[model samples]
Target: MKIDLSFKIAVLLVPIILFDTLAYAGIIPEKKRIIFKGDEQQQVLLIANTNDYPILMQTWIDNGNTQNVPSATVSPFIITPPMSSLAAGEIKGLRIIYNKQKTLPNDKESAFWINLYEVPPTSKENKLVDNVTVAMNTQIKLFYRPTPLANKPEEKTLVTQLSCYGKAHNLEITVSCKNPTPYYISLSNIELNLNNHTYHNETQLDMMVPPFSDNSYRINVDSTNVPQQVNVEYSFVDDKGDVHGVKSTIRID
Candidate 1:
């Protein structure tokens, strides 16, 4: 990642909210997530400046750490034009080239993050205070697909392959799911029905299960009567960020 202090950019891990006013980031990526094939030499990401004013942009690749700065992170991929200035309503492509020095897992898919920093232009009136502008940082998931997995079924199809089971302990019921596919599965809107009762919450079960991994969530129930079986309903986010639903039944273990 290249840093240009001349722009007087101040990077923050979280969005800056000044009193009642919110600082909106002007840059938008064309895709919600990126899939990079090992056979390809490079992957390109197109971003646009939606605001009426020009903004400075900085990009970097990290190992899924939200607190990692550009200089502290290391990865096999390099983004071209790490730092640049975009005119208002201008669209530009960012080239991501793999260095090939780092050996990633061959059988399973690897994951990384693409971070973009948008620095708005400093107001002339604020320049008297040293011309510092707050920058908004955004990150998206990037999956590296080796050549071998290219022939397999799409990730969306693998949603049906997930196996789940339920177990009750004390006043809580635990639901565990196993993802056998090589691709990661991002789940949301998880709802479990047991004994004619539905257990669902806004912040309870949203998670991403890694390849060949298991994820479990516990839901508290008031009744001591635990059901022997459960119906699991969930939704997964695709590469395009569209949500799709899935239903399955699991027995208590």
Candidate 2:
């Protein structure tokens, strides 16, 4: 459904706050992230409203900034029907159209964020009364894959090219992964077992290592001695956001 101009203006005026607490969202994205191929001019995203009440969803593409609203954000893509309403148990599709005016890097993948602002129906009777109306803003990763990279190997095949190692400094140990491929690696449940002791990474559980880059996580160790053999167990997400677990022996230096 089309949102009126007045309501659309109000949504833009509302302060867009990024909350750390994740609440149940009435509007749910069908996929974890969107992979936009350079060959495709437009892509469609399916969002479903699972709540009993209707909700207004405003979408925009931003360059990794969650604070930027639809009016102020600059992106190469524009979402069709930026603002629309969904009835209860309704499914709607939002089309992302790429503007050829802007130029993005063609060698590697560029990342952006697609924001979904969900606004609930406010009561007219409680308009003048003091009430806390909480609105949820969800952000999903949008990767622009150039046409040339399509012929390259997939993430699962390139996963073997990643090298994991460990380093010891004083009472802490650092675990590092070197990604030599052109695909972004999203890893989770990273664990290092040494001498039957499990060490969890201090970094975020869901870590995305950029293409051709290295990410290191520090873990506290009782001794400064770095073992020669360290068993590393981790899970990496593919392009489709599916997780695959891997176990390998890493060296310590």
Candidate 3:
């Protein structure tokens, strides 16, 4: 009877011990997903959870190619409920920004991966824990062509010129359009790339030029830091809703 009792207790304790070991080793459950908004801009948000445990996460963009170089790197922009204890049934949101210009294989469809890591707990004295990670996949589509215009008016021809200046940490660009036609134009779908990283904005400009006249616009590249290369792309729509695109590149020393 005594032997049987001891055997049963050992079996029950074994499973419990294994579970606790896994949990303590940062083997907790986790999930992640990528989301985007439809606009001329390139940005995404990463949503994740630790299933009731506090965790430390790190993220990167894989661009889904075997080229061995990631298309983008995320600088942990925000951490919600920045506390050590991530109570049970808690959700966390992480914002990730990608400059479309820095990504490789420009004008082609690419894949990206967001990796999340669960940081292990450590002790004050000889505290060391193992780390575990989970990943989410996404598809990045690049639109090289301009969208068609809407509401046709009168036919016209226009000439545009662009100039750029580069510094160690930022860029300045200017665009001038000569309107020889009778109608106005709107510029949209503006994208910029630096050092293989890309940046985009959704704001479109309504360029007004008197009949047989000209118009000019300026864009500033006040990036947080300087990049190795810079490229700019944009599109315009005529009064008749006809759309067109232009691309330019610059190398920084």
Candidate 4:
């Protein structure tokens, strides 16, 4: 009886190559939204192994707005259990702690992201070993909020000065919300009412108006279908950095 050395080597390399590809693509985190505030700066994220086999999971944090991974020393936050194994149907906690010495500014909220890589565990079973292992990675948004010393203004006050309008000369529906107050405003649940039609675009719109800054969302519809007025409806984050369901409507002509 004889065995092929080349075939054995190719089988071994396949899993490794697949795992590396998975790590590059990333795994999905359990939590979609992560808010860090108050006296406690540490948060635990629970990740579950929904697969039938064991998986090795690794985690790291990066700037949410950027695709590049952050530097180890430059990142104030530390990810515990940078690498761990998860059994089938297992759930584990990944602790993320923020170093108080390198905390964010007290005036505004900052954004970061947690990414995970999941790889299949090697097995002695011939069937398991023969199967091609595919790895995956997921990234979730992480918000770091500074504990304000003084009470922040109400959401209405923070957004009362918001102005939403339409461009009579152009094909775009413009939503302009200027944050006149010293508090930051996260305008979510945004819907634009134009040309007697309502447009509900959830994914493409991420509006955050910083303190004393002018923020606007330009929605390109069509100049031929221009409306007489534009009505914008949105929700904002409260003093505790929690998004409030309260809705505010503004008009633009």
Candidate 5:
């Protein structure tokens, strides 16, 4: 029996190519999530094999001021045989704990991340080889909302104040009309201004606010692509179809 040299090489390369593709796409087995202990702390978990193939996993905080800091206080949880190598499909856990004192700033409310990088396995001399190390990681977002000290106010008169909290993005403004009168009210138009750029839209409402009761509408502001600013203008129509407007501003850091 004679085998063509090119055919033999192709047959041998198929499995290696497939495995490399799978590892690059992060199809390898792994699990990740943010574990909350109480109100002020949480943990990021990463688990992968580190046997004959060593996987480098990088972890960092994505949202807060403490971004890109390596996992120090948090350690990789591992279980291996005394003298054996970590085989494929084996499991290991890497946990990174985020403490409030370190991860958050004053008045900060939430934290989010993009993704974690899995450094390919390298030799002790840091040379790349045909290793079978897998890259599997995830992003964990932790939110911290402290309990309010005072009693909450009623929502019947719903007073919502919209403002830009961070760097503003695509910015647009909308206003909802509420009629608390017995007769029907009509709204004619709505307008918005930010940093001298004007945005206006026309709308009509055929609604009635019952006696001693109220009707409500909403104002939508889309700031996805707008530059960061401190002022936003909202113009709208009242129940009498008359033009009315309000100016609101927020600080962005």
Candidate 6:
């Protein structure tokens, strides 16, 4: 196992609010994803309750692939506060810690899920209200970067494989994120430069491409103008608190 350079990753948490005829719940966060690594082994997520009454939120980390499923055995690498209660219009910090001493693969990145289940103040007693009056639990991907034992993959690898071309039938242009390498690619801000016009995704999708995966998004712009190139913005957090942002471009022609 080899320790690589450090980076500070930024996860974008968005705002969410729930409204029902009988109840209202809110959990507003700055970002959706969280990165845990190196000396900065912990990240604090600020959660705000915009509701009028108190709400009990259960916090935990689960494997990234598995969803809201409950497991008898818990994950040992990440630790989250068991639970928290927020009053009306109150905000609280949920500290997530990555155990430094724990043994994890140093060759690649591992992913997990962070869950915040908002239990209605009267959930236990009024179970029937769950159908229409309760807010769904919030969850996002939590990534862990293990020290790389070998040469790290480059950002150009993702950029080089991207493409934008129109389909023969519908002429809808599809932008692709093709990953030929073994490393997973977390991608964002994929902008297409066509003829003289440019377009980009507004909201972050938190899209990731597994090794050798073909991922594509359809651009709603005019496909008649052949795409010239694409500008991509990718980022990750190092073991230190530094956040590395890489901007790379790929020519479609």
Highest TM-score against the true fold, candidate: 2
TM-score of 2: 0.80
lDDT of each: 0.76, 0.76, 0.39, 0.62, 0.36, 0.56
RMSD from true fold, candidate 4: 11.7
TM-score of each: 0.79, 0.80, 0.28, 0.65, 0.31, 0.56
Better of 1 and 3 by lDDT: 1
Candidate order by TM-score, highest to lowest?
Answer: 2, 1, 4, 6, 5, 3
Query: How far off is model 1, as Cα RMSD?
Result: 7.6
lDDT for predicted candidate 5 compared with the true structure: 0.36
Q: Tens digits of per-residue lDDT for model 5 on 119-228?
A: 55456554455456444444433333233311223212222232123332334333333433222222223344544556554343322232233443333455455454
Q: Write down the RMSD of candidate 6 (Cα, Å).
A: 8.5
RMSD of each: 7.6, 7.5, 20.1, 11.7, 18.3, 8.5
lDDT of predicted model 2: 0.76
By lDDT rank, best first, the candidates go: 2, 1, 4, 6, 3, 5
lDDT of 1 by residue, 153-220 (tens): 75557878888777878777777789998988888666777678888624642377789997877777
lDDT of 3 by residue, 110-167 (tens): 2234433345334454344453444322222122211222222432224243233333
Worst 10 residues of 5 by lDDT: 75-84
Residue 75, candidate 6: alpha-carbon lDDT = 59
Q: Given candidate 4, what's the lDDT at residue 241?
A: 39
Q: Give the per-residue Cα lDDT of candidate 3 at 76.
A: 23
